[model samples]
Target chain A: MLARLNVALLGLLASTLSFAGDAISATEKQPLNLHAIGMFVLFVSMTLGITYWAAGRTKSASDFYTAGGGITGFQNGLAIAGDYMSAATLLGLTALVYTKGVDGYIYMIAFFAGWPIILFLMAERLRNLGKFTFADITSYRLNQSKVRTMAAVSSLTVVCFYLVAQMVGAGQLIKLLFGLDYNIALFVVGALMMVYVTFGGMVATTWVQIIKACMLLAGGTLVAVLAMSQFGFSFEKMMGQAVSLHSLGEKLLFPGTLLPDPITALSLGLGLMFGTAGLPHILMRFFTVTNAKEARKSVLYASGFVAYFFNVILLMGFAAIIIVGQNPEFFEGGQIGGKIVGGGNMIAMHLAKAVGGNLLLGFLSAVAFATILAVVSGLALAGAAAISHDIYARVIRKGKATETEELRVSRFASVGLGLVAIVLGIAFEKMNVAFMVALAFGIAASANFPVLILSMYWKGLTTRGAVAGGYAGLVAAVLLVVFSKSVWVTVLGNAEALFPYDQPALFSMPLAFLITFIVSKLDNSAEAQAERAAFEDQYVRAQTGFGAAEASSH
Target chain B: MSTTASQNAVYARIRKNPRFAELVSKRQGFATLLSIIVLVIFYGFFMVVAFNPNLIGQRLSEGSYVTIGIAAELFMFIFFWVLTAVYVKRANGEFDEITAEIVRDASKEVK
Candidate 1:
């Protein structure tokens, strides 16, 4: 009964993105490619096999949420890297570099700047304090009902926006790769995601991510190396040719073209930096490790892999500027220097074809599809945990729910979120939802980051302060985005935007911190006193792992 | 469990231990220092991009197509990665040792 409903939901979502118009018009009516479909089928079959194995082992809440905390640091690191480097980074950033030149590299730097800081500041304390979700840490000593509800609300918001963006992108992607209708593509992705999370849970999800990461890293390296071979493996040679061919010419090497203003640059940089630290899916990776030591190692390995992959993507983009830019076959109607076949985002795939022909392109296409699948699975799981663990078990049940009951709720929540993502994806197809990704980051930085940091490092934080600050950040981010140029002028057809900046982190993040600090200072009730007093034990556990939640002994 | 008298006593003792203070202060200082360094490096790059786009656009030397900004960022990516390794080495080694000793001392006091 539920499976039929899920399929219906996916059909609705797929049709929605089909009408999304410009967002995915590149592959609107393409025919199926047998090679691409075959490769993707192979991936789906293998992952489903892994899910079958994982479901047998997933007998408890811990296993479902975190693979029983038995994952080694290195494995967890790859999964984290897999989670972070979505299809957007692989395809969208490459397109950015392909067009904007050095500006794309600048964006990559901003995206990457968050990891080392996460390691230095949050990873250990997070591992020591959190059990299943980030709510574990925020509600550790505060009012469970209030704090958990706030965290769950913000988490679901971030997840839903992000999930919709991914689902819409997935429909477009499947159209390009497999020649399937957008609705059919959405159904396949939505169904696979639900099956992975509802049955296989985190263990299946992590392994899928790990496999996709390997494919992406390998596929990306192959494209870069093969393309760079055309330039005889010299960075200077590749840049020299790319600069001469690009329309921007020498200006491609500069920063002024993409981000002319300092405020916008700073806002974008801050949003990507701190927002990365607060993402629930990323934070949940820390709890999968055995201890604080393994958690620290996860960040170290994840950062290394991500930094290296971004650099490889830089090479692929530069190589594409020369390889794909010069080739007429990959262009629309063989018009050189004109429209690309699969839109601007297909530059990476075109470069693969130019270097290694159809086989490599087919492989990269499968990798891209797999990347989307892995990322959405992680997002769905995080969203589900927020519902089952935070809202249902802690808030609604008053922490009286049994383990089996909690796990069952989580499975239902996973399916429920997957359906919501499909419905929203379809409903917002023509709404210019490109702003959702930036909005997600803004909320993460504003609503989630401030309260999370203060709860761990500050003893003055009370339930009233944390809850108020969290909502302030959430509302401020959403309102700012609604009034910003992206939504106000482009989507809403307003004459002028209420907010000038596209990124809201600079203004809203500080506002959240200030509210949290002031409200905490004014709090003077006995409950506030008890919350402050309990901070010592939380601090001890956070510091030394004494009496911290332990890994289940299997 | 945290409200139980014995657990509370153990936590109080842990807080009172001299090594516990040392661990928290040392680790906190190191983490703050590293975090500041990262913020400076990242924000410095952004500030330069905002104020002086031309400087970053210029080639490392005349006649080279590779600009200073791209090259610097590539190195910074690797450099940021090395920073993670540096903190982890000290943290998983020295800081973790201090944490273990503090826990042991606190538990002994409770007994």
Candidate 2:
């Protein structure tokens, strides 16, 4: 089945290439600056070196899984910031805000809302579980094999969607920022991410994330500060300038102003908010910290940093609107939007170039590249961990595995996953990367979030129920997204779409929750009782970190 | 059964720690409520502006609205930090105690 899927995917790619005309040719004319290329290389080399050094001491599975459970709150905090602040947040949100106005704030609201939920509900529990992946937590109370299967499926689904989005974004971003061909750009990014993950594992990924987070925040802050300085640091004057440009109105105060309708806006918001807690890459970060308390502190720090950085992004977006509106000709010939000029995503890059010149533009572009690298590496790690740790080592091997053997398997899996993502990136080169990101989030929220939430909170949740719920939500959401008008028209260039709903959460989420509950309730057996007891014990241990400490001490 | 008793005893010890006891009694509940309140207020303000455009429309240009929106966003961003600072101070003073008690109890089980 997997082989068949790959073959079909390749066919789709070949057809897309034939129709689109020379995928590689589009990238040949614009050679990237040596300085920007050098900066990217420097960052990647440093990250890889640091990660390799860290990996040397990782002799045990625990070390591989949770960085020996020694990560500080502040370091973990920065890592969390890195994990959350993907290219989607840095590039996509900034552009959306610039183009759409008020509807852009909806993304901020949805994204930040998930943090409180994480702090209050999941952080401590996840930290206490002390496993490398979320499957350890969800499967603790159910049949191990069944839970692992559900987890693998959910993790793989979310990771692949996320990976494709990041890679596509990378390809487009490289072309826009550095004027590189899409194929060359994708290949370069793919190679860099593979190097980072294969050598350093979590340590390299975390450090790179930290560095990228710092760069993104610093870059955003500098732009905001510069833009404000131009306005003499007077908020009112900036508003006046903006007002003069006719950029403010009812659209700035309402949800549906930018979107075509309220339902789609609400769906977008739902996906962003619910998707945060469900994403495999983000959830896996909690396991890297030492304990529940550290996890909580890390989230607290992340929330603080994320909120501040987003504010700067909002400022930059508005600055772009006012500045760009005043000088439309400045951005007239750039290949963005429909005419290949001044698309929303290019606002930040264009702003940097206009305000600060080549130096700033080059720096910001490097930061954007790093953002893609960090996020893709994390997603790849999650996919690798899910495959090697959960599916292979735990289920297939039945817990009989040597440390060296497991590590080798994980590294190999990382390479394989990276290859798959690169291939997918090449295939879907023309699709709007943001749409893929939204689909990934939607799938995560509908398919994974429901099962994860219920499994942890509800004692009656059975193994059968989890599997049923997970697969149902996963299949339904993917099918709905694939058949939606966005995919058919925007991605495949097909006018006719089979699915009526653009967002599947309104139906798929409830369907998942209902099926899981019903299935668990109908199951009655001694094994079920045992499963319930084990789950309850795990929850109790997780709340207190008793079982984890015991295992670690041994 | 004795092991379960010891675990319960550890829980009791955690409950007996004054910092833990106080945190459990008030701090977590308060932080959770405070976050909810802030979100409500923020969303409510948006609702008001969204429902009654006339109130915000007095300001000229979509750009002015964008400016105001950005300003509000900046304020909220700072506000989250203030909230975090307050939480951190309280957590260090109170929540840390509960956390310490739990860790202490877990350490005892390990030994």
Q: Identify the leading candidate in terms of DockQ.
A: 1
Q: Report how far residue A104 has shifted in candidate 1, in Å.
A: 0.4
Q: Is the docking of candidate 1 incorrect, acceptable, medium or high quality?
A: medium
Q: Encode model 1's per-residue lDDT on A483-526: one tens digit a residue.
A: 99999999999999999999999999999999999999999999
Model 2 lDDT at residue B54: 40
Minimum summed lDDT over a 10-residue window in model 1 chain A is located at A18-27
Model 1 off-target regions past 4 Å? A1-27, B1-3
Clashes of each: 0, 13
Write model 2 residue lDDT over A246-322, tens digit each, in one string: 44533554444544544555565566667888899999888887776678889888998888787777678777767
Which CAPRI quality tier does the interface of model 2 achieve?
Answer: acceptable
Candidate 2 lDDT for residue A201: 79
| Candidate 1, lDDT over the whole model | 0.90
